[model samples]
Target: MEGSAVRHFTPFWFSVEPVDTLAVRGAPALLNCSAHSDTPARVDWKKDGTFLNLASDDRRQLLPDGSLLITSVVHSKHNKPDEGVYQCEASIESLGTISSRTARLTVADGDGGSPGGWLRAVPLAIGRAPALHLCTPASVEGSHAVERWLFSH
Candidate 1:
């Protein structure tokens, strides 16, 4: 049996590069920050200027490859606040620290389709001739009341 020799690490340094990613409203997004080094380094991600707190938010998760994964993206002021500059940093005990370029996270604005929003739901019709139903109260007393449908071209 042959014995394997343990490899030692040197002062090798690599750049941390994070690419800008686009995400649609109400969808998932992933921001990747990958790097390489002779010695393993600690990776940390920051948003806008503050360090990300992965423990507080359940929708945010830190992947094993030093990437940030967003569960759902909501383009609203009170909802998800994920639109901002993102940066990745890598540091080693023996080696030096390196930070990646600032990547902007843009969340696409979605058309507001709330119940009382401006965009109302369209009535769906299957055939050419549509049917219209008018409901009236039965407790009406009238001598000669006639209802007629008027059509205008």
Candidate 2:
């Protein structure tokens, strides 16, 4: 076995998976996805169980890092296009393909009302000084991350 060389192979896997996100109407949204493999893997996206063609849609862009960026979310009473379940797929030649967890993109109105309703804040007294901290009001159901993103935009 002297001077012999051996090669190890690594299969395709997702390092960063997309998560459920709440996007505001007419605001930018991002679905994070990252994959790795011994060979170069091409990343694609699926929306509502159908293959998404990023080129056909001008509003959608696939970032260099494999993340999908939606320039503007479209949602209305009669027409809703961006609200659906999404999944990222990574594939390498001769290695087949692997899919990430399904993440849902919910579109909310731009009126500051989320699926979780309005966010409330309460004053906490700390040694005679009151500090305002964000607290989920009753009937609120969503992550702080989503809430922060919603308000930030």
Candidate 3:
């Protein structure tokens, strides 16, 4: 994309799919974000409009491929300033900044010990629908191409 340079320039950005939202409390989660481009830029992890400290002693880590890992995350932590919305903003030099679809992290009822906890989730279900990813994750993540099956319904 080429154009005249005005006072400021905004780059053509990328897009994230309709996110598969999760509702859980006191459990670790990883928000998977995969990019189609390799342009070096900054990716921000934000919770409730503020910068999330990914380097804290908490197991939360910012994966290099653009995913967020929330270790031992509690639902109580998400209900206030941290409990609202989480967004992944990617900024590229030529492409400016774009964000992932905001994920509404909610508190789930009951403990996460249900036998169905490991069942097919609402968004991705192998039994209900044959799953096919339009774009697959890169070859970096160890289990990128592997798909597991569960027959006990």
* Top lDDT prediction, candidate number: 2
Q: How would you encode candidate 1's per-residue C-alpha lDDT over 30-126 as one tens digit per residue?
A: 6766668776777788999898988788888888777787877666867658888998887887667788888887765445332222221112243
- What TM-score, to 2 decimals, does candidate 3 have? 0.54
Best prediction by TM-score: 2
Total backbone collisions, model 2 = 0
RMSD of each: 16.6, 9.9, 11.4
In candidate 2, which residue pairs get closer than 3 Å at backbone N, Cα or C atoms, i.e. clash? Answer: none
Tens-digit lDDT track of model 2 for 8-106: 676779988888876667777788888988788899999999989998999999987788989878889988889999999998877789999999987
* Overall lDDT per candidate, in order of appearance: 0.62, 0.73, 0.54
lDDT of 3 by residue, 6-96 (tens): 5554333444422444534445555656555556657777777777887664657887767776655554533432245788888776666
TM-score on alpha carbons, each prediction = 0.60, 0.70, 0.54
Cand. 3 Cα-lDDT: 0.54
Candidate ranking (lDDT, best to worst): 2, 1, 3
**Cα lDDT for residue 34, model 1?**
62
Colliding residue pairs in candidate 1: none
Candidate 2, residue 104: the lDDT equals 90
Output the worst ten-in-a-row residue range by lDDT, candidate 2.
Answer: 127-136
Q: Model 3: how large is the Cα RMSD against the reference?
A: 11.4
Error of 3 at 15 (Å): 5.8
